[model samples]
Target chain A: MNNFDVTVIGGGPAGLAAAIKACDEGARVLLIEREERLGGMLKQCIHDGFGLSRFGERLAGPEYVERFMDKLSEKTVDVRLLTFVTRIEKTAEGFCVVTVSRDGLERISTKTIVLATGCRERTAKQVFIHGTRPAGVFTAGTAQHFTNRLGVMPTKKCVILGSGDIGLIMARRLTLEGAKVLGVYEINPTPSGLTRNIHQCLHDYDIPLYLSHTVTRVFGADRLEAVEICEVDESYKPIESTKVRVDCDALIVSVGLIPENELAESVGVELDSHTKGPVCDCQLMTSVDGIFSCGNALHVNDLVDFVSASGELAGLSAAHYAKKAQCKVNIKIGNEFLYLVPQQLDLNADNSRVTFYFRSKAVREKSLLRLTVDGQEVFKRVYPFLRPPEMQQLVLNMDKFAVQNGSDVRFSIEVAE
Target chain B: MKSFNCIGCPKGCLLCVEEENGEFTVTGNTCENGKRFAISEMTEPKRTICSTVKTVFEDAPVLPVKVSSDIPKDRIFDVMREINAVLLDKRIDRGDTVIENVLGLGVDVISTSDILNRK
Candidate 1:
């Protein structure tokens, strides 16, 4: 009487891969997509640089996602497009997912649910750019959509704020379309984007990047006319005397991205403060049993290859969940890490070969990561250098660590002097 | 010696290429891709460009396009011009060539998405 064995709640790279893997594992899967398109944000992201690790080819976003869409077509999974899940109720035997679409409302019951809800971009308002409400200010994602998907020039002359990856890519995209980008202003001392991005997207194009600088105010009534810029101190407070004005038609901001998890929160899933996403174990299972999370819903990932890897792991876990009893163990990490995925480990499950994704809190040179179980050093790896923007994935055979219930498994970083 | 960060991936390796006695050696690269990149970069740099093209479709105003192969780094602007000149009157599928042998570079400009064919 169940509608499906697995219900995937997104259509992005993560959800698509999760559903595909679940179906391949002989489970009846249902993929619900709120958007009309199945590829999610990748549809608007036409720039190449995707699938380097997975496919070993520099593919554009659309082309990278097309491979998954092609495989999804052959599966027996039910595809729901332009549908919205209103609420989820924990039933006696399983969970009830109530959805609404153009036709009407429908309820489906499933044993397991996978949340692959991607993320949202932070807007100018979120960053406190005060001024008149103008039409020229757009998030980097919106600008990319306008230019790549809709074939519209968002701005003729623009000033970009924030040195994130999206903003840098759009700078080049806008310039190629004959727009003049004045310069990219970032408040942080170091750029927030990947090194390859800063080099290829900004440096190769000769776009100037100003560090320790920020845009304070937008100066226009209807359209963007000019913006007030200033230098910030060590505390990130603006230096009042260092104010400057730059005139431009638009302000493209790529401040940051926040994981979308309202639905997960509604279900009372525990969220990690550092990642702003659901707390998951080695199998990607959430705090609530029968509910799993992957991709950006678990945490923002730097590469789509890792996103697919997590999705596949979650899908496989969901399919074989009923096989054994899951015993959870919290894996502790030091403050030197920005965040770590798989916050816990399932001792009862296969402890061999667990992949954990993490990033350094800041730039660290000649750093060594120490993994200890019960006060005994289990593993250690040295990194020549680590940056916050680049996420590193480490695969370990937990069996060798010999960690068990109540075992103090901790991860800490140290500078190799 | 000339230094350039490898653009192969997000892991930006500070690559230094030194040509001593006509023998080229690349240092600080983490992988083989970076090594090849250094050699090619030192010899003749090549680049690939991705942009949008104007289309007649109402629902989709513009379609994403990219060169089928890499071209000389200097010809990026020229390749962009060739792609911009075309106003696609017919709906083309993803990977479909919009311009064949564009500017006699033997590289075709292909649509990156099937968004235009939806209508």
Candidate 2:
């Protein structure tokens, strides 16, 4: 069996960054990808707007990942493309990762494993769009692949359901390609995408964004012909009185993204109810020791920059991880937050430099985010606005918090009265 | 007077531009980039266009390309048209210039990905 200090599954940005960081830390690393290419979904994301935080430049998705891929190619880490890890068994001596590739089945043992298996887009079935399975119905990612990668026009006239980032981007992309985008419909009262995307993609393009509206059902036999748009109430209950019919040839859905955690679940890693990713400590190690998770596999991050940051953390931690009793301090947050990453803190480790990624539960104006340890305020920042679609990140120095194994850590957001 | 929300960062600060005596004053910016973005929004807006160029490779039908620098906002469609018309006949890696000094503009239409040469 091949052996390495760190084995990263999925060669996306997270895995690439993780493998590279581990290798840089003097750990023998192996990166395995299921696709022929190292880039994950970034390959098909041709639009610019990435790397604003990391590189301080507006780079395209491919370009953003190309930077990481280039650095990784120069490293000593072993990269295996078109290789899929089938099963992972926790043995007494680290973890045994079984794989299936062109050469057939093989096994590799690694001291620590980083699950960077990214996320998958939610399909129409998950959103409960009732209709005959038509040819024109496509997910936002599929449409992007057809347009950006294959150079094929997936639709002529389309109605997008969900104002998610992909849907908003596709609305502009399709419009730029001479397609007719009727309008973007969202069940939520507010837009689901970033405000900047709304300004540039939809508003700049003259495309309409209809809030509190959704596609209840679609019509068509051979291809999509029409869709039933209904207005939803505060509780998302469909108001039958406000049902309207819109004619469109295609229905593109970008409901949401779900973290791929079946592999983590198979290995008995605890999952968080809010983020749907593994319950990880400040070190990014999951409830199962020696197994870490990062990137979208940990939580669906709005920005790819944060994904790379989390991967770096997980990789650096995995490389330095030793079999020792972890003293973890639980972190609690109020209902003001949708979720927070690094659910717990490793008291035994250096908790001084912790990168926290979080999002408010609702749209908040003039809000203050306070981090308190042992009932003492350590850090607090007031933001002008906070939206669920935009994630906020902070690199905090926890040294002054004087945290201990039994210390209570809490985070909360208070809106200005 | 005009207003814009700076997309330069996640802060998304609302920037208001007021013109008095042919001079512009930007306010409500959380950072220096916001002021610059506000000035650009009031004057000439520039944006970078990223799209795919047709390729001869069958395995990879299109190669992703982008302008090396931002162009005038009004010239986005012109850049896209020039990008769409070019059909790459030779294998080119990332950073290879697809069209040098495109349309007399300072930026070059360069390949942003190496997918065409991978196969």
Candidate 3:
């Protein structure tokens, strides 16, 4: 029965930052990781284009995470590796986390908990890709693990089923590793990856990207041999007449990522239908008091910088957590936004310098995002263009809005006339 | 006019470049980096690639490495060949060069991770 002031789960970039920040705030912190090593997905993401905002340099994923690992080494935080959290129970004092590791079952009590459990990729079965169970089908993240971490090539000639950023990067990675990436087939008309990734990873390597096309079926029993591709309509239904079979050894799926929240759900945390994560407050605290959510557990963030920023905030808030009544007000949004983080605001706590992350529902030119309180515009910002793939972040003085517990705090986006 | 997205930053501003007798005029750039990127794309394009190399240690099978600077885009596979040929047996720290003056491009391939040295 170990006791701690704060316990940070998952040793990814988010959890690492949270542990460091909590330790810096003079709180006794403990970090638990299920893997043999830390760094999480960053270890497999051995590509550049990370740390541009935080470090002001284009660093590889290992390099970006190593900086945080170095900072965490100087702090006095207890780290447990190869440990898996089985359950989290709410206690009268705070929380009791049950974990199983090489040493066996152990329960730790903490005043507050920060959930930094990252997201998981949508698999082939999850996306409704009907196919024979084959050996060559893998998610983009799985393929990345095989190549970057394990040094094993997962495909020889493969067809990618989605245009997500990881899939785009893999197209170039496999090419550099002497594998032939036939083409990337995205079900949507618009590419799902960042514009820069489409250029640097695909265009630079002469990898073709076919939009509005999807792999409806995969053929192979022992190993993946070929795949059935078809042109999809606006409703994403396959147009039967447009079906074509292509020979390939593998199918890499990069459809989407879903936030891992089973532990949060076990603790009775309410989730937002849009973001598919815990409905959090301005401080990144979940609906369940004393339990904070950040990083991909809060929402699927496109950039790691925002993930670390949210983790730092959650860590600081959890470090100062006390049992008290909360005054919460829901934050409403218009139909123009795909989703927004921090679905609610706590009037009882500090509201100054609250950060919001959001994405537009569609591509729009000359758009304006407005924040209104009680039908009066409190803040507004103009953008030249907004895309769904790129999430936006903004920091505002929320205390200036004079929002009460029952006040209407709404965020809306409108295309400029 | 040739239009393309700038890889300068995540903003991904759409840059339009026009060529007029060896002089290029670039528009729609938010910063000077985008302008320079467009100019380089029109001429000799260069890119930085980060990849892993095989190592002798069983604990860490591969070590991550990257070019010290941007190399010519066409020489990527050529550089990969040189990187693949190396079978590193020493524990090198980050910024330690794996290959010096690789392919005479005046850039060294350096290790980007110090995983072997981590205790």
> Interface RMSD (C-alpha) of each candidate?
1.0, 1.4, 0.7
What TM-score results for chain B when candidate 2 is compared with the true chain B?
0.92
Q: Please list the residue runs of candidate 3 whose C-alpha ends up more than 4 Å from where it truly belongs after superposition.
A: none
lDDT of each: 0.90, 0.90, 0.93
Model 1 residue runs over 4 Å out of place are A323-325, B20-23, B117-119
Positional deviation of B20 in candidate 3, in angstroms? 2.3
Docking class of 2: medium
Model 1 per-residue lDDT tens digits across residues B1-119: 98999988878899999998877899999899999999888898888899988988887888888899888888888988988898999988989999999989899999888776743
Q: For candidate 3, what is the lDDT?
A: 0.93
Candidate 3 lDDT over A1-417, as tens digits, reads 389999999999999999999999999999999999899899888889888899899999889988999999999999999999999998888999999999999999999999999999988988877878989999999999989877889989999989999999999999999999999999999999999999998988889999999999989999999999999999999999999999999999999999999999998999999999999999999989899999998899888888889989999999999878889999999999999889999898998998999999898899999999999999999999999999999998899889997999999998876
lDDT of 2 by residue, A237-305 (tens): 889999999999999998999999999999999999999999999899999999999999999999999
Tell me the docking grade of candidate 1.
high
TM-score of chain A of 1: 0.98
The superposed Cα distance between candidate 1 and the true structure at residue A22, in angstroms, equals: 0.3
Which 10-residue window in model 3 chain B sums to the lowest lDDT?
B110-119
DockQ of 1: 0.81
